[model samples]
Target: MHKIAMAMLGVALLGACQDNNVMPGPQDGRALFMANCAVCHGADATGNGEMARAMAKPPKNLTLIKVRHGDTFPRAKIMSIIDGYARSKTMTGPGMPEFGVLLEGDLVPFDSGDGIQTPTPRKLVALLEYLESIQAER
Candidate 1:
């Protein structure tokens, strides 16, 4: 009886661990962005959030990302910027805080279609999808 109880408890614990590994989907992206970025990027992601009003410089208009990048969304650049690995010249002190820790999660492999696989966090990928979906059609 003791062994059976212990086994059942182990199985329950294992199931809980598995639940934590479940990857976030694209649908979760908007909520994550709202919670983490809306202060400066705005609810509509137009760079006019309430926080931007208090800053010395207004945040970049995220909707224009593709338009500014010659009609191609710069995924790598966006990821780097979010992770604080790359900082744009236009960015000043504390304009964008690093979100690496918040974005870190299960790495889901994606084929870049150039013979290289990109191991990206599920959260980051979802966030990217959300950003792409919100790009202004110009």
Candidate 2:
């Protein structure tokens, strides 16, 4: 009886330890942006967030026409940079945190299976789309 109880407990614990991974949608992207990016990137994606003044380097005005390179805003470049896959001297500052690990699309267990860190590919793509939507035309 004792051995059977222990086996059941172990199985229960194993099930509880499973990683909770969920794919986000466009609304999820907006929520994620508002929660994580809005503090530095602004609610409008304008780069004029509340923390803008405390940092040594001000965030880029993402909506400016001059900010876009060439004829089109580089979407892939922006995504890579946000994911921390791309490194830039200009992107360095206290305000920006490296998000590569968070964006790596790995499933990791959290406390009591209540929380987990999962990749938000859709959210990321949506964010890029949002940025593109707001980019000033040349």
Candidate 3:
């Protein structure tokens, strides 16, 4: 099957990048991004990856998220976008596929600095934290 072949290819690529043959930690955001996202979003989180040129719509220049959001990095909002809750059903699978698959993991208390703690997924939080750290000053 195509999926099986892709899985084998993925394993080979990952193995070539490691020293101890260990997988990246589930909550290691930078590792997560480089492995899963850099192909489309670029290692620096810019929208300049090689695949971007082939797509009908280029990926977002992620460093400007805070600038576009009025100088505040909206944590909950970003998480929704990442996990696909922000996308309508009709809007799925083209420009962006549903990453709600990322939601299927452990949860931890996350405060959006809003005085309320949400039971957020650790993986989502890790990725979100990494994105926030890369905000370009505007």
104, model 2: CA deviation in Å?
A: 6.1
Model 2: per-residue Cα lDDT over 42-89, one tens digit each: 888778899987778887787773355776667556767676677565
Tens digits of per-residue lDDT for model 3, 1-138: 999999999999997775432222434778767766787789888998767777777889999999998999998788788877786565432476656656766676777778897887777777888888888997
- Candidate 1 lDDT tens digits, 47-71: 9887898877788888899999998
Model 1 worst lDDT window (10 residues): 108-117
RMSD of each: 4.2, 9.8, 9.1
- In candidate 2, which residue ranges exceed 4 Å CA deviation? 1-28, 65-67, 89-93, 100-120
lDDT per model, in order?
0.77, 0.63, 0.76
Candidate closest to the true structure, highest lDDT: 1
User: Which scores better on TM-score, 1 or 3?
Assistant: 1
Candidate 1 clashing pairs, residues 3+ apart or interchain: none
**Weakest 10 consecutive residues, lDDT, candidate 3?**
18-27
Q: Report the candidate with higher lDDT, 1 versus 3.
A: 1
Regions more than 4 Å wrong, model 3:
1-27, 88-93
